[model samples]
Target: MINNSSHVNWRPTADIQSLRQRAVIIANIRQFFALRNVLEVETPCLSNATVSDLHMRAFCTQFNDPMSPQQKTLYLQTSPEYAMKRLLCAGSGAIYQIAKAFRNEEAGKYHNPEFTMLEWYRPDFDHVQLMNELDELVQQIVGCEPSNRMTYQQSFKEHLSLDPLSASLEELQKRGCALGYEHICRDEQDKDTILQLLFSHEIEPNIAKQRPCFIYDFPASQAALARINLQDQRVAERFELYYKGIELANGFHELANVSEQRQRFDADNAQRRAFDLPPVVTDEFFLAALESGLPNCAGVAVGIDRLIMLALNKTKIAQVIAFNYQNA
Candidate 1:
């Protein structure tokens, strides 16, 4: 019932040749996992609970329970993380999943509301060991060399001549102002927010310009699900991979303490409430699994579309995605 003119824009964003190349890359990913004995996993795309991260928003829907004749709200999963961790707790060992994840209010040259995520968990591996494996995977996928690893503080010091951890709020604000983010209200922002603004505006653009790089040991306040470093309580054992100034992956030494996890979730919800955003319900099942005991593991989530973009030398994420959100 639609006109041909209107249908003209319905074509896929990626050409057939590009899609074929994408398929080969995906196959390579599966092969890489198979060679490492990591089990492939599949989790439900819908869940009764969603992440409490204040920065992330989940899509919601209602499920009509025929047996109870009631409607129950469900959320499209932001990632397969919660379910995958539950599996790990249930003795699935090392596992990986290439999942289609959804997030609300995300669409741009580098983002889509729906995109593929490559997530994995490795039991008995610390963040460093996981980073080694990640390096190998990236090299195999893109023929890129292994990356240099640096601490978050070191990166800031090297690039901006400021030690992020030791810098005062005023110093950070001054750095932000110097980086052309002078419009950012300094009085209302916390140290973490100011550091984030400075990093995004100044340091991040220059990182990994020559090759891929991993920045680790983030400030405790910026740790999402990472455990605090016992050696340095001020820092968390988290790392993010960047290639050509584009963020490619985020990983953490998984926080195993249930109480600490609960506190972090509560804090995130409180921040959401302060911002006048609806607070999300925390996943009780995930928490229970953690309480039962999750093994020492490190996990990482990679953006597949971005990886494809880098591999194929494409500029925009749409060049790798079959159909962007606008067309979808």
Candidate 2:
């Protein structure tokens, strides 16, 4: 015999009032983009490839076919970027997508495994133009002007008194220890970890308290796929928008070099190997498209659920999601 008297904690769903507000904001956003002639699109959630970024983890699935002794692998896309860029290469005009993206390791007050993302690309536009448009889009959605803009170098110098473009690994480690970092890496380090630590601790909390802020001109090593600014050879033309100290979006001046991109992808896989993680096969289709020709463009992605939560002053991401991970 089993005991049958267990009580279940039945938490309610997202607040209806907040949901309505989110709906309104989304509607307005659609109107803004539609008026600007941006074509809305949808891409598959599952794919054979995933982002090459070392930090982002993708969820994988396996399929077995009975007709033949064959197995297939699929990944829940971390971002819709690859597919959207393929469309760009195929001459799709200015396009945007409201997509549900997945990540495996992210779960916290401000993060969930699954969340909504608003991604867009503008052909023939540089990162500067996209930055301005980011400001306009946020203001139009929130009905308020954002704060101001600052470069990555300026931000680091102002907050940590460290030059991110030239700071040594030892200096970064020292700063991290001084700031109460318990898990500092002793091995040879790169700029990414140092920048992430500083951004999360010193700079992020102090940004956009009054309004939104755009932190642009990232170090060249952190460019990912963004193009380096010709005037500033040490920095890439990329920007991240922050609102109330929460990161809302990231944009890039697309790098259209196929060979360079392939090399970066290989490097990422090599890093994965060093970390004892399995390397994903490269997306040959996307690479072939790049080889053929991708339009000169700028692209960006905004966290929609975060935006909704911000609009309602909700602190926990679970409050906005229909079913939190534990519940799911």
Candidate 3:
């Protein structure tokens, strides 16, 4: 981390020209949405409740009441998902937002504690239609062609000669060990985690290197907010976009079943307890909105900084952001 007193660290990581380019990109994004008649909206950055995803840790602060004696803890939103879904439930059709998001336990070449997120929702769109729209938006921003699409099973089969969906835990462990991950005790790890490890370390690097690629239909165990496929009950209607092995976006065909959504939230909290992490309070309001009937929709959150990094051919995420966590 750079010392706070350092003069050079006070300057923006990105050059002035790059900042200007970023502005142009943001303008283009607004234009793209405006042409499609998608209303741009804003939501709260801090909330009384936050995501219960086991993989994400939210930054929190105590909100001391000046007029009252009560103090409440508020969490910085990891994504604008829940609030946007609430809007969708209120009959806001096809909305988008560019907002600041925060996550704890993240800081590296490709990650920062705080970053910009471009999130949007389409009320009647399915995951495939959303994927096509995402492809168009990305291509417009980066001047790249439409991304190649593949299923998660196909990616694993083509890259590692393994079927991720059908592979047993023992098979996954054996393959992981053979691939130089002997340090991990396969027997103690879950199948989904093992699949993630292999996909990140081996298969991902071989995905479309010159253009973007969309990997869809993930295992049911890996689904966060995505609905499960009816034809194939073992997979979820989830997809992630990657460019040169770097994940840029994650989208889901929104799960509207209240009972299932609550169960997922409970499971996430249970996993958090197992991991020795503090359990986050479930967003009751968001669940209430879900109960009120959120329209069938698809939503996606894209890392704007990472997109800029790729567009400018920059190696580090800090090169695109005005100020990184260390300096901020």
Q: What is the C-alpha lDDT of each candidate?
A: 0.91, 0.87, 0.92
Query: Stretches of candidate 2 above 4 Å error?
Result: 1-6, 9-12, 65-68, 185-188
Estimate candidate 2's alpha-carbon lDDT, on a 0 to 1 scale.
Answer: 0.87
Candidate 2 C-alpha lDDT tens digits along 1-328: 9765466545645776777777888898899899999999999999988888888899989867576588888889888999999999999989999999999986888888988999999998999899888889887776567559999999999998999888888888778777877476344376578679778888999989888999999998888889989998999999999988789999999999999899989999999898888887899888998998999999999998888787777888777766677767
lDDT of 3 by residue, 1-328 (tens): 8666755557888898999999999999999999999999999999989988877888899999797698989999899999999999999999999999999976999999999999999989999999999999999888887899999999999999999999888899899989888788356468888898889989788886989999999999999999999999999999999998689999999999999999999999998899898888889999999999999999999999999888888999989988888877
RMSD of 1: 1.5
How big is the RMSD of model 3?
2.4
Clash list (residue pairs), candidate 1: none
CA lDDT, candidate 1, residue 304:
95
| Candidate 1 to truth, TM | 0.96
Cα RMSD (Å) between model 2 and the true structure? 2.0
Instruction: Give the range of the ten consecutive residues with the poorest summed lDDT in model 1.
Output: 180-189
Worst 10 residues of 3 by lDDT: 1-10
Q: Estimate each model's TM-score.
A: 0.96, 0.94, 0.96
